[model samples]
Target: MAQMIVRNIEDSVKTGLKARASLHGWSMEEEVRHILREAVNQPPPARTKLGSRISGRFAGAGLLEPLPELHAQTIEPMVLGE
Candidate 1:
C-alpha cells in the first residue's frame, strides 16, 4: 500500500473535513481516503454535443408551427459617464 502526504491545507478546510468525518462516523484520515477513492473511481459524464442533447430531449414532443422570419434590430451602443 502506498501512502500520500498532503501539506499546508487551510484550517477551515481541515475543520470542514473533520466535521464530515464525524458525520460519517470515521476519523479524518479514513474520511480523506474514502473521499479520494470516491473521487478517483467515479464515472465520467456523457460526452454528447450540446445541440444533439437539446434536440434529443424534445424528440418525443410534437413539433411546433414554423417560426416566422427574424428581422434584424440594431441596438444603440452604451455611452459611458453621460
Candidate 2:
C-alpha cells in the first residue's frame, strides 16, 4: 500500500470529502481508491454525430420541425439601452 499527499486542496472540498467518506463508512483514502476503481472501469461515452441520438427517438415526431432561426444578427433588439 502506498501513501499520497494531495496538496493545494480547498477547505470546502476537504470538508465535503470528509462528509462523503463518513456516509460510506470509509476512510477518505479508501473512498478515493474506490472512486478511482469505478471510474477507470466504466466504458467511455459512445461517439455520435450531431443530432443522431435524437433523430431515432423522434423519427415520427415531424423531423424535429425546423429549428427556429437562431441567427442573432437577424433579430432586432426590442428595447433600447438606457
Candidate 3:
C-alpha cells in the first residue's frame, strides 16, 4: 500500500542498506520499511542526558553530606515564604 516516493538519496548509502538487508534475507524495501516502523514504535532509552542520569544513579542514597547549620540558615530564608 506504500506508493509515495523518496528522492535525493546518495547511492553509496543505499548500496550499504541493500547489502545489510540481503545479509538478513530481506529486500531493501522491506528492510527499510521494517526499520522505519521500528524507529517509530520503539521507546527511546530510559535515560539520555548526562546530568540527570548521573543524579539518578545516586538517587536517595545519602551519599552527599547534609548541609551545615549556618549555610542552611543562610539559604532557608530565601526559599521560605514568610
Candidate 4:
C-alpha cells in the first residue's frame, strides 16, 4: 500500500470532499482513495475524427443522399454594387 500527501487544496474543495464522503457513508480518506482508483482504472476514450463526429450528429436527420464534392469547383468573387 502506498501513501500520498496532497497539499494546498482549497477549503471549499476539502469541504466538498467531506460532504461527498458523508453522503456515501465513507471516511474522507476512503472516499478520496475510491475516487482515485476509479479515475485511474477507466479506459481511455476513443478518438473520433471531426468528419465522423459531424456525420454521427446528423445520422437521424433523414438525410439519405450524399452531398456532391465541390473540390474541383471554382469560386467567383462577388462584385460590389456601385
Best by lDDT: 4
TM-score of 3: 0.51
Tell me the whole-model lDDT of each prediction, alpha carbons only. Answer: 0.91, 0.83, 0.82, 0.95
Q: Per lDDT, what order, best first?
A: 4, 1, 2, 3
TM-scores, each model vs. reference? 0.56, 0.55, 0.51, 0.68
**Ranking of candidates on TM-score, top first:** 4, 1, 2, 3
lDDT of each residue in 1-82, candidate 4, tens digit only: 8899999999999999999999999999999998999999999899999999999999989988998889978999998995
lDDT (C-alpha) at residue 72 in model 1: 100
Q: Compared with the true structure, what per-residue lDDT tens digits does model 1 show for residues 3-35?
A: 999999999999999999999999999999999
Residue-level lDDT tens digits of model 2 in 2-60: 77788999999889888889999999878878888899999999998778987767778
**Candidate 3 lDDT for residue 42:** 95
Residue pairs of candidate 2 with colliding backbone atoms = none
For model 3, residues 6-71, the per-residue Cα lDDT tens digits are 799899989998998999898998888888899999989776799778778888988788544564
- The TM-score between candidate 1 and the true structure equals 0.56
lDDT of 2 at 29: 78
Location of the lowest summed lDDT over 10 successive residues in candidate 2: 63-72
